[model samples]
Target: MASVLRRKAADRGKSLLDMILKERKFARSIVVLVFKATRLRLSRTSHKPGSVVLISAKICIKSNSFTRLVEAEAMVYVSRSTSIPVPRVYSAFEYKQRVYIVMERIHGQPLSVDWVQRSSTSKAKILEQLRLVADEMRKIEVPEDAGVSDICGGPIYDPRLPGRSHWGPFPSISAFHRQLRNGIVPDDIRDPESIPQDLRELFLFHQQLWGKPVFTHGDLSSLNILAKGDEVVGILDWETAAWMPCYWEYTAARDANPQNLFWREEVDKFLTPNPQAWEAEAIRKKYFGDL
Candidate 1:
């Protein structure tokens, strides 16, 4: 009964907040006040300046020109389709070319914090839970004809990509690979002399690669994973979540931030490792810089 009552109260609060947010002047004022007073900020190296802030103990709002509604949509889809612990989104909308996502403020520290100091047993336990969460995420039904795309079947955003912009809702893995090569099709290169020998080999290698698209959290960095004790409490930052090639998850995890050097070794424990894919990604990154 207490749980039911609490749920009702939460629903009421969400409704009230929704109404409050609809008032542009009032919402702007509230955002300004929260920015000045809140201790919780969801700033990341990849996120635009002043994108996310905690509005209260329970609510966080991410709003900015770089914020996309698909991020909120991804969170909602994951919450409904899987048991992966993610922030509960209360409201998502857009006004004046900016997107706003109001969601539950999950209280936990990122796994990157103190991860190296944790005991071996604690690390194993966290990895076990993360493996289960990854499995559950893979079970989500893929949309028909889906290629590389966001949850809404739109272009996907990945800061690691060269332009730090939306890429494609490509119809096939081959099409997506072509984009990765900056539109250079290996078959179209009639004269091998026109391109560098190494570049030609890289293109050929990628052309032969094939995999069915699967749901992928494109950025599986330790900094994005929140935990309490040995339990993973939440997976934050779904902006880059999408349907991608099967090897993407492993490669993305392997490409951890420079600060998270330890996480690169731990990724294989929770996610399948694809050394070949990692090699291919390294070659691509060599030619076209990542971010």
Candidate 2:
């Protein structure tokens, strides 16, 4: 009976949210009002600029230019397919060119909050749990012919990239690499002598590194990981999650912000290290500056 009542309540909430979404002006007004009135803002770091306001004790809404509806979709996909703990999305939509995601407001604090003070054993336990999360995400089956893309096979967004814009759902890893090289196909360069020595080396290195597509949480900073008593209760910020090359997860985690220096050093403890991929990424970034 309790389960049935909960389902009915959820359905009613969805219906009301849909009605509000239909009225764009009213929805925008409500978002602004709630954002200003709310005492708590869930988004803690400037690592990703966005506003996540707690509308109620149990619910929150994330709205920003950087947020995308696909982030909500990615959370839904992960929640259904894996044991990884993610926020439960209620509704996601775009209004006035800005995206808003309404979701469950997890009560835990970010892992970075007390990380420096935690004992070695507690830290080890948390890292072990993260390893399990990494394993579970890898077990998700990729569709045949799947390329690097957002959860729904749409273009992906990564702020750390050169333009901080949405890029292709490339047909293959090689095609993706070609895009990275600004459409200069390595094979098309018949005269390697014409290219700079470093550029030539990078192209050749990328060509030899072929990796299978796997589900990736592209931003795995400690700030995005929520913990309750050393147990990771939720992994927030799914905007950068996607189907990416096998090396992506490791490199992304390792290449975290400067503030996350300690976490960056500890990433390999939970995630499988791909030293070659890290070197390749460093080479690419050396030539093509990131945001």
Those runs of model 1 whose alpha carbons end farther than 4 Å from true positions after fitting are 1-50, 191-201, 209-211
User: What TM-score against the true fold does each predicted structure earn?
Assistant: 0.82, 0.82
| Model 2 C-alpha lDDT per residue in residues 1-291, reported as the tens digit of each score | 655544443334444444554453335544444553342222344433347865555667888778899999999999999989999887777777877787889989887778899999999999999999999999998888788888789998888778757888888888888788778765787886787776776787778756668989899999899999988999999999888888888988888787787898889999998787787777788777653
Off by over 4 Å in 2: 1-33, 36-50, 187-201, 209-211
- Please write out the lDDT profile of model 1 over residues 207-252, one tens digit for every residue: 7757668999888889999999998999999999999988888888
lDDT, each prediction: 0.78, 0.78
* lDDT, model 1: 0.78
For residue 165, give model 2's deviation from the true position in Å.
2.4
Model 2: per-residue Cα lDDT at residue 175: 84
